[model samples]
Target: MKKIKVGIIFGGKSAEHEVSLQSAKNIVDAIDKDKYEVTLIGIDKQGSWHLNDQSSYLLNAENPKLIQLNKSNDNVAIIPGSENNQMIHASNGTGLDKLDVVFPIVHGTLGEDGSLQGMLRLANIPFVGPSVLSSAICMDKDIAKRLLQSAGIHVAKGLVYTSANKGTISYEKAAAKLGTPMFIKPANQGSSVGVSKVKTKKEFEQALALAFDYDNKVVVEESIIGREIECAVLGNENPKASLPGEILPQTEFYSYESKYIDEKGAELAIPADLPEDTTKQIQQVAIAAFETLQCEGLARVDFFLTEDGKIYVNEVNTLPGFTKISMYPKLWEISGLSYSDLISELLDLAMKRFEKNNRLKNTVWDD
Candidate 1:
């Protein structure tokens, strides 16, 4: 049997650029060599796509370990369409490496916001994670919450505002609408980038300005005080949930630093210490949230269990963090699936989905 050639795509023009690099490294390292031949495709913070070689593009602060793919000879172009269709134009101007699968280990914006998936779909390649629509929907915090709420899932109440609203919403007026100690976040960013814990009118303006740096639309939600829990959901259609994990942030909340930097920042309790009923409920809600956004492949659903024991779905990450320390992978690891095996499963799902998608007819001839 021939080993599948898998393109491990990472890094992008997003606030989570560094985080994406770490994820790509983890996937590249854990991907089973026996079943897959890996090729690295790195997109820089500036959004320039480059084939991996001796380029230090792969090396980053969070991911110091480096492994270079032997593709120093060419710039590859993905040809659009389904049916074993892809033309990797070589840089040496010779030959092509037909990718049997694309494992996009990128997070945020161009990576996880359905843009990359759209390109992959056009290129007609099997890639891990959600479809274009699901990715786009889940990438927006406001949209994801609305969908979850519509699905009968409990979600925190929040208000959406755009930078265009500028002078329209005074800090005092906005705070009156949504109580203080609210979480202000850019709708399109992930890994807690441009996310702020605003407690006062003065803090609200600063937070809004910061969030607008990352996205046009900002979401402000009343902070739910309680344990922060995360559960990883995998598979397509009937997905399974991994054991819940508790996030112990070193700061006010799970900020970017606590998420990626600061070694001793956050504590993750795998198979989080929770009541049996609570665990089951969280798992069910996690799956519901995944399906609510029409997510495929995988997602990590976050929730807040209030002091009163009320569970509120925070948000769902269509392309959640894949770093070794990230809850997505750790939860599965505790759920009897090794990191390598998790990678294998994701690729399997991608291929299976591609085959299923191939069955649909794209165009009809009408004379």
Candidate 2:
């Protein structure tokens, strides 16, 4: 049987660039080589795409803080409308072998905000994760929360602010509305890249500055005093949710360091201890949020479960982290899917969606 040529695109001009490198390394190492041929496509912080040699695609692969894309001379560009679904050498216009599908691990900004997905769609390529619209929706916390709330799903009370209105809402005003110890984050970032927990007025101001540095818009959410629970959802039309998991953050909250740089920053409780009824509720809500956002392939739905049993939908990660320690894969692993098998299932879903879309009539006149 012919092996599928899978392109793993990672590293992007986002704050989560290092995190993407770590994820790509794990996928490259664990994917079934016998079933799929892997291609390493690395995008540097400067946004240059390179066809990297798999062995040396990432520099300082073990160190999260130091990990970066190892640039190569084989810079490449995607050929839109190409029948072969090929990427070409930017310099000589030489075409590389067609990729059966792409498993994009780019986590934030241009990578996750529908930019890369749109490019792949134009190139007529099958890529893992959500569609362009879903990607954009999920990446923006403000819009996602509003949509979830409109769907009868509970979301944290918050206000969205941009540079134009940044000075209008003072910390005192925010605290009066949402209470103290609010969570501030960039509207369009992931992996908690520019997230901060602030109680004092000074901290609130500082956090706003930091979050605004990452994106023009910022989200200020009331800190829900509840267990941080997460559910991994998989598949296309009929998606399944894994048993919920809980995060025990050693820090005040799960910061960027806690998530990636510091290994001991958080303890993950897989199959979180919850009532059978609560578990079922969480699973149902997870699937509902996934479908509500029009997410395809996979997503990790996060929630805040209060002591009184209230469940608030936090956000949905279209392409969650896939590192060895990441909750998305770990939850699936505990729920019966192996790491290698999860990758295969995701790729298969991508191809399935691609075929379904291609079958739809593009023109009124018959070819």
Give the candidate number with the greatest TM-score: 2
**Winning candidate number (lDDT):** 2
Model 1: worst 10 consecutive residues (lDDT sum):
64-73
Predicted candidate 1 versus true structure: per-residue lDDT over 1-367, tens digit per residue: 7899998888777877777777887787788888888877877666656677523445334432342222233456666773554755544544357789898878899889999999999988889999999999999898888878888889888889887876676777667877778888999999899999988877988998999988999988887878999999999978999999999887788888887766577888888999999999999988888888898999999999987778898889988887767889999999999999999999999999999999987689745
Instruction: Assess every candidate by TM-score.
Output: 0.93, 0.99
After superposition, the stretches of candidate 1 with alpha carbons farther than 4 Å from their true spots are 54-57, 60-74, 82-87, 90-95, 363-367
In the range 1-367, model 2's lDDT, one tens digit per residue, is 8999999999999989988999999899889999999999999999999999987888888888888789999999998999873699899998999999999999999988899999999999999999899999999999998889889999999989998889896998899999988999999999998899999999999999999999999999999999999999999999999999999999988877887888899999998999999999999999999999999999999999998999999889998988767999999999999999999999999999999999999899987
How does candidate 2 fare on TM-score? Answer: 0.99
Per-candidate Cα lDDT values, in order, are: 0.83, 0.93
